[model samples]
Target: MQVDSDPDWSALLIRVRDHEDKAAFALLFRHFAPRIKAFLRKSGASDTLAEECAQEVMATVWHKAHLFDPSRASVATWVFTIARNRRIDALRKARRPEPEDLPWGPEAEPEQSEALELRQETARLGEALRQLPEKQRALIERAYFGDLSHTEIADETGLPLGTIKSRIRLALERLRHQMS
Candidate 1:
């Protein structure tokens, strides 16, 4: 009967880096995959995601094994550090919010054609109001832009209430026809 000897992880990593050793990689995978998976799951990942991330961490180890420094950390420390960083990156990606699509908001832009039509209609209404008699223009301005009730306009202008209402009505009818 052959006795099983514990393999050196640092030597296995060096073999994988220098010689692309499959047996060394298999040894590393067998030793570390389950531990990495457990670490990820304990840190809040689902089992399926933990499995996938463990596979990625091992692939990184295979490619970057040459970067390991034995003086600074043991093979297990290096591998587990990589696994922890990968878990942080995955959590950040999962938690990020997607961008909002915004024609539905309160500040949404009007269509170009509709905006242009409103501008032209406003210009026409302004020209129609300018063409009115100055007395009528004054009464309309006081009632609408000046925010005055008929009684207020009459008090301000020393005009009869009936005269103020009639002038404003006629001015609005002219503006409607011109705009239409």
Candidate 2:
């Protein structure tokens, strides 16, 4: 079959979203799966790990296609983002500490005052995060909670690496000021 080098991805995503169109999904899978696999491999995942992550990413796209927002991100960016998140999650799970063989023990609890202070600090940080600009907050969340590198963020956001770094740096400075 002849392939359109520049297919209209937004249209395909709409089809996937509105009608659960398998043909549109097939087109997306054909185009993005190998790219996602390559991206995972470049990030240091093994071939088998990359393949599994790529499959999971595509499956997520099929299931979550309705969540796609073309105004916010192109289809490739969205797919790569899913792939990136999946890879990070897989790595985190693989690195989880193994449970010890010893029997469970009742560990000492923290002091009530210390626990209250920690909770207060968490609340403050949450408020500060809420006060940030939408773009800034999104960058912060993607970098910290999403575990995406600057390069990956740039790719997914379709921004320059320098822009991503600068925004993150400025956002961090603002957060520090707000916290203080």
Candidate 3:
């Protein structure tokens, strides 16, 4: 069959969407499936993964054909966009830690001595923070405690970016020295 000679893909998709026409769906599958697989492989999916994801993408195209907007995109564009999103989802799923690999049950509590040491360190850090010059202390609090970026702090305080960075750097150096 001449698969690439300008068939009305959008019309076929509409048939799949509205009439659930098997002939139209077969035509779309024949035309787009291999292209989707090749696209996935080019985007760095392994052969097996590409093949699997291509099948899934085509299935999605079949099921979601009603969502297709010919005015917004051609059928090829819609199909490839689904293929791309499926690849991204597959990559994310592959990267996720398997449930079997995770540590089970509640975490062990810290030893009493370790807890005491942590409290002491916290006290020292608090004292050091209190001893900092108000300007430096305020910047450090805004950055580390308030969870604001230097740019955000600058916007809030109307300080130059350089001044915010410098004060934070100096404050960190002093804290490091005190901690050590």
Candidate 4:
């Protein structure tokens, strides 16, 4: 059996800087892909989309790692920023205008386009929201998605009002942590 080596980010980064080290790229991909996927999923991407985003992010790392500045951000932060940008691009891709088989007036068309964009963005956000535990996720979905008030959520879910508030607060905290 082959032993897996621990990631040596600084050394791997040096190799990446040389522009010839596929091994370094491999090592970096191995270590960071899961985190990227988790981040995207928390941000509201589905599993498949998050996986694709992770791949795109790593590909970017391979190309742009040479430009990386450790002084600006840690390796984790750098890799995740790449992941975040790629995720935004992927969300944008999903929000393209649909071909109108027939013209439905400019007014209707713009509204439809905006709705599609909102749906794509909401899905991405929901995916991230879903990464939270059932309690936290439910709190968020009820408050925002279902338009429930804190009292309403507490009543509907049979959770204490304080518990509902706390869960929502914690979920936002977790999301903020993952994002930055």
Q: Tell me the alpha-carbon RMSD of every candidate.
A: 32.2, 15.3, 22.7, 15.3
Quick one: RMSD of model 1?
Answer: 32.2
lDDT scores of the candidates, listed in order: 0.73, 0.75, 0.75, 0.67
TM-score of 3: 0.49
Candidate 3, 1-180: lDDT as tens digits: 122345767778889999999999999999999988887775567899889988899899989987775545567667867876676677655433324633533645334454335445555776788889999997775663343568978997999999999998999899989989
TM for candidate 4 is: 0.48
Candidate 2 local lDDT, 1-180, one digit each (tens):
112335767678879999999999999989999988877776668899989888989999989987775544567667867776686677765433435745534644334455334445545676788989999988887775445788988998899999999988899999899778
* 2 or 4, greater by TM-score: 2
Runs of candidate 4 with Cα error greater than 4 angstroms are 1-6, 92-180
Top lDDT hit: 2
Q: How many clashes does each candidate structure show, in the order listed? A: 0, 0, 0, 5
Residue-level lDDT of model 1, residues 5-38, one tens digit each, is: 3355766887998899999999999999999888
lDDT of 4 by residue, 39-125 (tens): 777666889988988888888887787666443444655675676567557765543343554533545223444533443443445
